[model samples]
Target: MSESVAPVSRRGFLAGATALGAPAPAVPAVAQPRAGIVILIDRNDPHVMGHAISYSGNLSRYFTGKGQAVPPIEVVANGLGIDVFRADKSPLKEPLATLRQMIPTVVFSMCASSKSIAESRENLTIQLIDGARLVPFGIGRMVELQRKGWAYVHG
Candidate 1:
């Protein structure tokens, strides 16, 4: 008995060749420790301020899950962004305060220069929200954080 050889179509040959030549699917490298993140906020809008605070809290929740170390999350506010940090002027006082207490790792920072400018303009002392720290300059502080391997995010 003679065995018949099947004829291969051009399309079938090319498809097989392509499949054989395809590279293996890429996979993520070994699990890496969560890195720190810096969130920059420069607008004076209440919505923007609230969004930044909420985003920081979300990041904190994600990084701190599974008993992982609480990576640093710095919310740096500059220019008019200082308005949100103003204790008396900010509308998000309640929510921001709650976030501060719930996630201490998510720190809020306002620019001293911006505070001075706002104070000069308003002719009054700008009291920052409780626990809000002041940086010498927002951009400068961001640069320092970036140099230290903290990822930068704009809010």
Candidate 2:
């Protein structure tokens, strides 16, 4: 004798689970309309820069794919994170330049204070990537963006 197995539908399973007091699965939050987004990177590691770049690219793609306009994105690098913007020391120069070209609305900002400090401490001249802008202060820039209703992400 073969044992018969009952087929379970998705609706049945969910209803049964709910009836058993099992919590419902969470749904992802919908994207909110915003002026723009700013990403803050304060680490000196190349990995941090890579993550920032990847996240920025993904956000841009997500909005465009969803038929929504992509918002302006800015990556503000300060503290040790400023190293990722240095042409001579950074392994990300080429990739940064390419990303700048590929994403028109994405911009990279390097902190002037951090560059000065690094130059004095490390005794090395720092050259930023072609499209990177020199901001007076990375933290200040982030604050400014936040005040303007831009979403902030720490990477």
Candidate 3:
């Protein structure tokens, strides 16, 4: 009886070699924690945006000092606050631009109802980031955030 040698498939050998030669996929070393925070801004009030920005700055500095990660902060702006989010014509343009640069992690939630009012009454272009999550009402959003385990500080 003659012993026969098994034939190895070229494709299978090449695939195994390629897989072994490749380096392990690189992973990000920093870990991000899930922190939820809600900040309510009274847009109808003339002083709200200034206060909110100041509060945000303080909160960010506090978190940095503590050596702990800050939660995602959402600033819900309605009524007059929406003015900050308005297209080029906003009076708070310079302030908003500055705030945006400083707090890149903050989410600015503009009220859709206010946008509708702007469209009908003033023909204002409410420039918002695409597909932002809408709360039933700006106040409702504040309540919702509080109920959903988010820390709330009204400024």
TM-score of each: 0.73, 0.75, 0.64
List model 3 lDDT by residue over 1-155, tens digit each.
99998776766666666699965445459654454777776655547767776777778788889997766778887776666555644555566566667777777777777678777897655566432345557877778778777888776
Residue-wise C-alpha lDDT for candidate 1, range 12-74, written one tens digit per residue = 766776799965445469755456889988998878888888888777777668667767888
Clashes of each: 0, 0, 1
Residue 29 lDDT in model 3? 94
Q: Global lDDT for candidate 3?
A: 0.69
Q: Looking at model 2, how many pairs of residues clash?
A: 0
Candidate 3 least-lDDT 10 residues: 125-134
Query: So what's the TM-score on candidate 3?
Result: 0.64
lDDT, model 3, position 38 = 77
Tens-digit per-residue lDDT, 91-152, candidate 2:
78777777777797688899999999999998987888777889999999999889888999
What is the TM-score of candidate 1?
0.73
- The global C-alpha lDDT for each of the candidates, from Candidate 1 onward, is 0.84, 0.87, 0.69
Instruction: Check candidate 3 and list the clashing pairs.
Output: 43-81
